[model samples]
Target: MSSPASSPSAPPDTGTRHITATILLACLGVFVSYLPVVGVSVALPVMQQALDASTEGLQWITDAFILPTAALLLTCGMVGDLYGRKKTYLAGLALFCLGCLVCLTAGSVVQVCVGQALTGIGTAALLPSTLALIGHVIPDPRKRARAIALWTAALGLGLSLGPVVNGVIVAHTSWRWIFLPSLVLAVLTAVLGAVVLTDSRAERERHLDIPGQLLAVVAITGLVYGVIEGGSSGWSSAQVVIAFVAAALGAAGFVVVELRSACPMLDMRLFKSSAFSGAALVMAVTLFAQVGLVFALSEYFGLVHHASTLDIGIRLIAINGFTVVLGPLVGRLMNRATPGLLLVTGLVIGGIGALLMNAFQAGTSTGEAALVIGVLGIGIALAMAPITTIAMDAVPHRLGGTAAAANSALRQIGSALGPAVFGVILTHRTLATLPGHLASSGLSPADQGQVSGLVSNVGIQAGAFLHLKTPASTGQAQAAYGASFTDALHTCALVGGIGMLVAAVIAVALIGIRPARSPQTAPEATAHPASAAS
Candidate 1:
């Protein structure tokens, strides 16, 4: 039996063309799939009014995309291994295009949700297949690391650029234009992928792990639904409780199924590597922290700050604008520092940024907020590329899809969970703070209730700004509301700070810093082809 690495492809020297082409092709999928999350947040009020959507229906529009993406990621990874990365990615692009068309024409909330779900599935396919293809096409460790860094940077670019594009489109045209750009981009990507991407499939023939896949889908959906809904349902509500229980059972079943399956959706044995485990945890937690910040930032800028939808998008973009510029620079730096060192340093910087925002008062100027956001962006750039490199490099060639899929899954889950969990914090804090303000000198109970309700409702709007109403009675409400928002910010910052500290500790203690060029430690380093050899 041939080693998986040696089965078909040329050695590392010959794979660069295929790798570059595939990465370019993969960028389209990343852009289309993730752009909606940010863009739609900016467009939610438009969507709500256009469709006359209920609050629950509006939430579903987002959840429809997230749940399916998280659930199907692992399965799609397996599919890439069983079939071929090129095949899977092409199919994904096709599916994504179809979903965008559906969204463009949707007259009802259900149709939008359906469209989102389809897009989510397509995204699942695109993500893992791209990573797995990288593993096949980039055979040299150094080149592969650089390639992975670029891949991650591309993903970050997609995420960062999504809202900016959406803002531009929505400002000039209708919300439907959001789908239009992606539709065109998707078709273009499909054509590019067809032309440039080579077919690369697994060497070992293995059946799909149906049981494991099913259980995983169940587990992830349950967990995501529970977390997302927990805020509205009240954590102690029967529905929330049931969702939690179902998630627990499903997750437990998935473990058992994977253990017994001949070809597992996830190989548990990989966790035996402390480096891999620590890296994975950092990816998940950092995403949790970062996404939470993004979520809150969207709300604060649009609703609380009373910025225009386009202004909100532009402002947020300005905050992270530096990151898009700095990411490649960091990628070059990774050639010098160990992944562990970069990861810890990035997390520390990002945590500080978050803490700064948490310390924010309603009195904070937009410039101050934007500066803090820029810091967070830099921190994300510093860590994300290196951490992804470490995790992907630790695993073997055959399981590349699985490892990538696992990483994507955790990241998505963290993103999903962050908003839901933090939204609750923001909500409670706002509500508690508003009542004292509502008790002002002249206001009746009925008017106070109305103002309080509106404040809460507005706070939930992403990319919208909020303002507190001064109570009729004295200047009571303004002071209290300020104090409350400040308290919430502090609490959020502290939580984020703790998470970063933990990540740093894990990084320093569990993840050893070896120089990136440690030829003595990694045999592959010495095996690189010299220019003469090439």
Candidate 2:
């Protein structure tokens, strides 16, 4: 990405001070981008009441952000390369700050959804651009690995603290105020990046691929939409069926479009390298288990155990906090050992931790929950940094932005899929089994039917019964709910655990230890005859 004038034959390494300043802005950009993700879920109830939102309205509040981020990723990476990296970085920050402002002042749910879309766009633009910036500034592969690890840690920090921060905001002030801190940080980072950061892009020529962009949008949007709706409205619903069809067609169409286009947005050949493909798949499935389980566990603690938002956030800190704590150590390990070995080891440990979560119940002690979740967090921390390093290192350095975009898009898709997959499992399992639990509670048939109807009608929101204390009947209802929910939790854990183990096996087969070779080991040799996207 360096200009001929700026890049020397043996370019001296970037200054420590300069790299520090660059990472500060990059990390800040990443931090604020993720703050709203888990944070908003904590505030959904207040949002629902304030806006009088319907069930559909509540779902869109989260999807509004995810759809745009998933759809725009590759396009945003190309934009950074075609326009200027610094410009996209600044634009992304400005866009996020604007979205926060809009949401903070929103009076209706529609406005909030719109604002969320804007923020999602900003995230799409920011992710690859920031990672590409790291690639450009740091010439040494070893140094870049460390930088990317810190970047990953920043992302973890944002996610870990989001709920805690939002919980405090909701407890003390309005839920609307949750975006205030993010807005301030976005503006600050934008100013800092504008002042000190040097702009760069792909040294080789590239162009915007309109057809590819459009197809990517169609494919990703359809898939995410179908999954989200399929869970809520039932998989057999007409709209859900149409959405899946559109998604399949769009995905096929996208591959054809990219292959035929003169200027492809993403070079499909990158996946030919075992390293890149393996890392990308690992990222998707890992997040699938991680984020998906978070959604289920949050509901478990909130509804079944009657934990407040703050308490739930506190409990989750054991998982996310360990990720941040282990970041630096993981980076050093990757530098010293075979990254693929670490990757497989982490996934295996994570799989074990996920399987152990089946033991959790409404009465499970916080200490017991923490011990299991902490193991999973450690595995995530160990594996996350190495995946980025392996993927980034597998391709030519020039393709860093595009590679980051592709990997990130998969991660987002996994995240979006996580909630949908687990939510469906939890909802269907809970509803299907609730009646049986009620019937066994020694209640008369009429009373059993009445309580069962109330819980069944609410679907998974039967967690809404967490606080009901009306009478003996209510106590019976709560006990039945706890049993049903624990069953569902066990089911979710079994599915997630199996998926994690399967992904680990795939990682072992596809990725190998990096061999010692020439300094020009990757990029130059990795490129094919039609490597140029333009």
Highest lDDT: which candidate? 2
Residue-level lDDT tens digits of model 1 in 1-534: 334433334343355565567666765567566667766666665676678664445556766777777788888887877777778898888888888999998888999989888988899898888877777766555666777777776677666677778777777877777887777888888898888767666655656888887887778778767776776667898988898998899999988887677677887766765666778888778877766656556655554554556766776674345546776777677777677788888888888877777657766787887788778777888888788777776666555667788888877777666656666666666667667655752456865665567656644342122333543332344444555655665666677767876887887776667578542334223322111111
Q: Stretches of candidate 1 above 4 Å error? A: 1-16, 48-59, 318-320, 440-446, 453-490, 517-534
What is model 2's C-alpha RMSD? Answer: 3.0
lDDT of each model, Cα atoms only?
0.70, 0.79
Q: Cα RMSD (Å) between model 1 and the true structure?
A: 5.1
Model 1 Cα displacement at 260 (Å)? 2.0
TM-score for candidate 2: 0.93
Error of 1 at 491 (Å): 3.8
Off by over 4 Å in 2: 1-13, 45-58, 107-109, 466-470, 513-534
TM-score for each candidate, following the candidate numbering: 0.88, 0.93
- Model 2 scores a C-alpha lDDT of 0.79
